[model samples]
Target: MGKRHSELLILKEIAELLNTGTNMDEMLSGVLKKLLQVTELDTGWIFLMDGDGSFQLAARENLPPALCYQNLEPMCKGECWCTDRYNNGRLEKATNIIECKRIEEAIEYNWGETNGLTHHATVPLRAGEEKFGILNVGSPKKTFFHEDELALLESIAFQIGTALKRIKLIQKEKELALTAERNRLARDLHDSVNQILFSLSLTARGGREMTENEEVKETFAFLQDLAQEALNEMRALIWQLRPQGLENGVVSALCSYGQMLGLNLQTEVKGLLTLPGRVEETVWRIGQEALANCKKHSQQSDAMIQFMIESNFLNMLIKDSGCGFIYDQNQELPSLGLKSMKERTESINGDFTLISHPGLGTSIKVRIPI
Candidate 1:
């Protein structure tokens, strides 16, 4: 094929390999196979630097999949011959494996060898100017990769590095979302079950004391009422924990949160409130957790919550006149409720801050993309 035509064919193959809709390992294997075909290398290997900066053999030509999964720490950082080439930023090439000091050392260590490789070139995989790993190509003959061939190999490395960065970013996003979900569930469990347990303990103690005096009898009855309120709160917590958010819509969920608060909660959703799935879930969880915190921690008998949707964004404000705790007090105990709310806010790429003072009032403001 002509040079331009060959380049275009390689690009086409890269695109198709990326769109294979397979798992990451399978995808990497397929991409490496395609690279070998396009470059006609005797043997090729892909090394990846994991999140912790440790190198691992991600893919290899003719290597068993199980062996390819082995980790290779202290890669070029060690006292190997390849280490010298990598540290000096020089691509090593040799006609004889024995003449290549690095290959000989690596072979002696049983790490890798040039038994089937004569001419070799190592391409560094870089993402945005940061080198993440090396793409080493070997040939059975000498000087297999010329300047043009090396350029093509470097381009492949760039493509692989870009894809790896994208995949890592996507996985990180999913992890953040999962972490937020776990925090929300944990807070719900604490607020509901723990509160009920406290209520039960109070009820039992009050009942025991009521047997001695009629005045204590009235207190026991009050405890019964409080227990019932705890039950209602538990139900609300369960509803919020449901994976599905506002099946009817954001408006419906906002209204539900309002009704659960037992106050005048008005939701004026202007523009479209249809946020991204993760964002929607995050906002709903934040709202639910905030309202529950208001009821549990606020001394206010009446609170107000408003949800407003505008161009490309959603805004929420919840205010209550209650015994507010100091938000910035380092000596104060950290509440799981506050931590969970903050995490949820971060997960949605939103901002959440509580304005409050002891015996004054509390106001929570949240702004997120719609």
Candidate 2:
């Protein structure tokens, strides 16, 4: 095949891979592998800028032994030459080939094999003016990329960028749909269940006042209390279906929820609490579940919540002084509420831990990296 025809064939294959209906991570990894195959490159990687303005190494293929042996922490920290330039806005074109400082340093210190790579070329993975990331490819002997190869790389990067944008749009649409459904449910509960609970409370109070028998009066008073508690629970459910105080922050929302549950909630916040919307939402949901668990399982009427924010992470603790259950590592968790809490925490790449004993109180701790 002619050189041009060969490049076209490779591009066509990559285009097919991108359209394979896989998730974004799998698709990008497949694209990187395909790129390395077509170009006979030793290694390739992609760095994607996340919504929080942090660049992360999203995918990689064919790492050299030396690079693989080294700790990944440095590479992921955006310390490499290509990523540094990209962050500094110096890498603005498909043809920008830069020497690999890490490779040079490795050679200088006789640390590890460079896999014959002295330099690598970076192409801006962008759609028009909006740049998403950098696509890097390298070979042992090639110090610079040819114009045709640069063009091909640019084309592949553009395709990846377009795919990423499409995925984001689809995710956003799903989130909006979910929010709409939640709002509908909230409204329905308010109009139906809430009204019924309020009417029941009123009727119970009237019945108690009209009854003169001491035993009957006591029964009516108990009924009235049950109705009132149910009303509070229904209100809390409505608030959760559509968070009202979330605009103020997760702290405020949780406090409002605790009030409805009639639980004595003590909250402590340390450091700046500003977070991304998704992060805040995740925290709020987990908080709701934890509090719900406390109300249902804990025999105590008080709980404590703590929020601590650091430079790179945010931590949360929910504790309840209630009758805790025995925990078995080999057995499935007994509470679906705790299981749901774990799932939600993991979805955001956060850490979750549950501590409980037969007599000791249960505590939930979460740490989410921002």
Candidate 3:
């Protein structure tokens, strides 16, 4: 095939690969491999900017020994030649050739096969004004890329950026739908379940007062207490389903929940309390589960929740002085509630730990990167 025809064919193949599925990782991997094959590049890597304004290596192809075998981290941070230029508003074009500090460092250390490679070309993956990431490719013998090659790479990068934007839009739509459903559920519970529970509490109290027999009065009183507790639990559940207080902050939201549960909650917040919405939601759900466990099993009237934000991580601790259960590995398994809490924490790439023993209260701790 002619040179132009070959490039067009490669671009078509990449488009087909990207449209294969909505799975971003799989699509990106396929794109990287195809880009390497079409361009005849020895190695390639894609760095995608994350929500925290950090760049994570999204995909790679034929990584050099220096990065594959050595202790080079997968993600890039701080200032690098290309990234610095991009940040300084110098990289205006879609494609630009820049020196590779990583390659220079590898050659200086005599680590890997650094043959004739000195520079790599970077293509900004962007959809209109929104920039997604940087696409980098290098070869052992090629020190610079030609205009035609850079143009082709830029086309591929544009395809990747468009795909990323579509994925993000779909994700946002899903989140909106989920939030709406949650609000509906919360409203149903409040209008129906909550009102019913409140009415039952009032009826039980009135019955206790009208009863003539001592035993009947005592029974009605017990029912009244049970009804009140159920009402408290229902309120707490409704709040969790739709946390309006989360608009202010997580700490304030949890404090309101504690009051609803009639549990003396002592909270200590250190460092910045601001967090991403998803992180805040996850923390709130885990806190709800921990506090519920305390009320149901701890038998304690009070609980303590501590929030600490360090330089790199946000930490949380929930403790109760109530009765605790034995945490036996072989004899017993985690309850469904505990399993759910752990799963929620893991979903956000957070660490969860639960400590409990007979006669000692339970303590739940979680740490998440901010």
**What is candidate 3's lDDT per residue for 100-131, written digit by digit as tens?**
88776766767776556677899888889888
Cα-based lDDT at residue 298, candidate 2: 91
lDDT of 1 by residue, 1-370 (tens): 5966885887788867665434567767777887877876657676665333335566777532222223533232334344344456553321122234444445565665345544456777767765556676666655555677777777777777777767767777987787679668857786768677677857766695759777777777677677777766666655666533377776677667667667556445556556666676777777777778777778665777777776456888878888987767344326787778878887766887778888988888888754
lDDT of 2 by residue, 153-247 (tens): 88889989888877877888888899899999999999998999899889888998998998988888898899988998788778888987888
Candidate 3: which stretches are off by over 4 Å? 2-6, 16-20, 51-53, 70-79, 95-98, 107-118, 213-223, 323-333, 357-360
What's every prediction's RMSD, in angstroms?
A: 15.2, 3.3, 3.1
lDDT of 3 at 255: 80
Highest lDDT: which candidate? 2
In model 3, residue pairs whose N, Cα or C atoms come closer than 3 Å (at least 3 residues apart or on different chains), thus clashing, are none
TM-scores, each model vs. reference: 0.48, 0.85, 0.86
Cα error, candidate 3, residue 245 (Å): 0.8
In model 1, which residue pairs have backbone atoms overlapping below 3 Å?
81-102
Q: Global lDDT of each model?
A: 0.65, 0.83, 0.82
lDDT of 2: 0.83
State in Å the error of residue 47, model 3. 1.0
